[model samples]
Target: MDLQQLRYVVAVAETRNFTRAAERCLVVQSSLSHRIANLERELGVKLFARSSRRVELTSAGEAFLVGARECLTAADRAVADAAAATGVVRGTLAVGVIVTTAAVDVPEVLQRYRARHPDVRVLLRAGGSDELAAAVRRGDLDIAFLGLPEGARPPGVETLALDRDEHVLVVPTGHRLAGAARVTLLDIADETFVDFVAGTPARAQSDQAFAAAGLARDVAYEAGVAELITRLVARDLGVALLPSAFVRPLAAGDPELALVPVADGPRRVEYLAWGRFNPSPATRAMLDVLGVRGADPED
Candidate 1:
């Protein structure tokens, strides 16, 4: 009936509990219940089926929830637009970044953004490239920095090439292979390797490199985070294939770690992804700061 009633229904649908929804909405449980009841009465349909132990949405409620959430999102965007018109970018921007990128430049990016627009709020989450891509597609992330799969394009998001990071071999400085100028895949095929988990873009690139060299790797360990893999290699657990940026900080501080270039390998490409439709002005500004632009004039 009204925005307030719709807000109450949406909150209850999300939390699936009257008390918890009321708490999140910053209202008393009794008031929230009254509002929801009035809304259901006006609509002549039950939104939620309730019992002493739990609650569940009715079929109609499940269908209505999507529209309710969209309405609230549009309302919030409208407010954000008005604020931007007054030279203030004030809204929550959810950003997702891969593990390595988060460590490399994300902190500096956020610091610059905060200094420029203190009113804008940012929520940063870290995950693997696949997970971050899924969040961007699901509208959970306003933008993301992730490795795009080879020949894979996101459904409703625009992609811009950010930067390329070369794959390299990471080992303890005292290891025999550490002195090599450029190591080929065959050189380490028999060595115990720390590998990225399968089904990720990084793994795909690494696999392609091995396949190109007419070799196969013996993976002794697998990890999700590059820094963790580096730590394992530092402890002499196993050598790892990692991006150049991921090894920079550790190589600077720890003299025992050696990063050797992998010759004749495919470079890892990082992409800046944002929803194609309904991107906020604040998001565009951040992209400008990230130095992403349209295709080069020569192209």
Candidate 2:
């Protein structure tokens, strides 16, 4: 009738003695006998033949015993599975990242996370900031690495500032300004700029930085990939202002391209974003692994 009743039946069948079954069940003999009687009555079948000396199973009892044992076994397995799911911390974690961000930091972070939580499966998706934001909003991604555009926060998402990286100007070795110790926005105002596509967070940041410095960047070309933009700079097509990390990998590739730090500059703040409604334990664990301390929930 119920799991306990099924367990009691199986215990009785195994022991073949009411007193011994009750002892094994850690229940009083009379109470155990009463529960068995109730189960037999509900089923309208005698489950056991009892005597003063011994107890034996009826034909119906033998048939019912097998089914009862199976039910108890299945119930135990279900409980074990539920506990494993809730407590073992093993599941697929879907993470989104901007292509530039992934190129810079994600590989190292993923390696560390895998080392720490080997049982947890990691799935990574790369896209632009807007696409990553949309994926988090749609619940397709558990968390994402995003640069807030123009300091505008995404609605219904929480963020933790990871690190601020200063933008550096990339110029070809033959270019005159490449020899400068530090280039200012005004210093490179005359040169054409290769930048990220319009509407991207990096572009917006570049525009704001130039605007704040009261200078206009001559737009020569636009490309989304950081590597491509660096290549363009290497070719002397135009100079570009990009995150320092993005330019680090390009340093060894092109001896002509110089990644110079921008003096008197605005640094880009990178944040980890996640849905505020209901964050998964795995997501929280990932933030912890990334050393991201979330904002106060009360705030």
Candidate 3:
């Protein structure tokens, strides 16, 4: 019925706990519960299935949440529009970033944008490429840095390609293929690998490349960071395929690590993306300050 009730519903749906949702909305649990109960009574349908173990949304709640989130996004955009009308870039800018060098210089872009438009408020969130992309699509983030499939465009969004990273094979100094000039997935198919955690961009790319070559790799250990992956390689745990930039600094610092290029390697392209419609004022300022082409030029 009201924005407060809608917000309570959304928070509860997202957190799946009334207490945490209330805390996030800066309200007491009882008040939030009462508001949601009133909303359900007015609508004459049960929204959440309550239990000792968990909170589950009912069919009605699931259907309502879709429209509820859109309502909230529209309300927030209205506020952002009002702020922009003052001809000064002000109000919140929610930005999400993924981990990698191939992505645009997030820190640099924020720094310059803030220097130019001190009135703008910036909020930063970090996560994997897929998670950030989902947040952007849900209107939870104003813009995000993401590592997408090479040349793949996200639906209903405008993307700016920043840079690309090439995958390379890393080995230990005393390893048999350490001195090899270049190799392919087939060349290293027999060797055990120290790999990225399953479902990560690097791991997915590695798996896809090997699958294309009709090779099955043996993963001896799995790590999530470049540092750990290189540390395992230094111990001769296994060889791995990582972004060239990730392997570069670590290989330079550790004499035990050898970097060999992957011929015809899989590459990941990094992008800065935003919704095609109704981007906030602060988001626009950031695009301009970074010289990034956004969804609209006349805004």
Clashes of each: 0, 1, 0
TM-score, model 2 to reference: 0.65
Cα-based lDDT at residue 274, candidate 1 = 79
Residue pairs clashing in model 2 are: 173-256
Report every candidate's CA lDDT: 0.79, 0.78, 0.81
lDDT of 1 by residue, 92-183 (tens): 78898887672238888888888988888899898877788788888888899887534554456677766677778889988998889998
Top candidate on lDDT is: 3
lDDT of 2 by residue, 16-101 (tens): 88888888889999988888899899999999999998788999999998788777645644554554576755566789888667
Stretch of 10 with least lDDT, candidate 2: 75-84
Which scores greater on lDDT, model 1 or model 3? Answer: 3
Off by over 4 Å in 1: 102-104, 149-156, 293-299
Once superposed on the true structure, which residue ranges of model 3 sit more than 4 Å away at CA? Answer: 49-56, 90-92, 115-140, 148-156, 179-187, 197-201, 207-227, 294-299
lDDT of 3 by residue, 187-297 (tens): 889998998788876577788778877889899899867688888988988998877865687688888989899886677777788866767787777778768744442
> Which candidate do you rate higher for TM-score, 1 or 3?
1
Answer with 1 or 2, whichever has the higher lDDT: 1
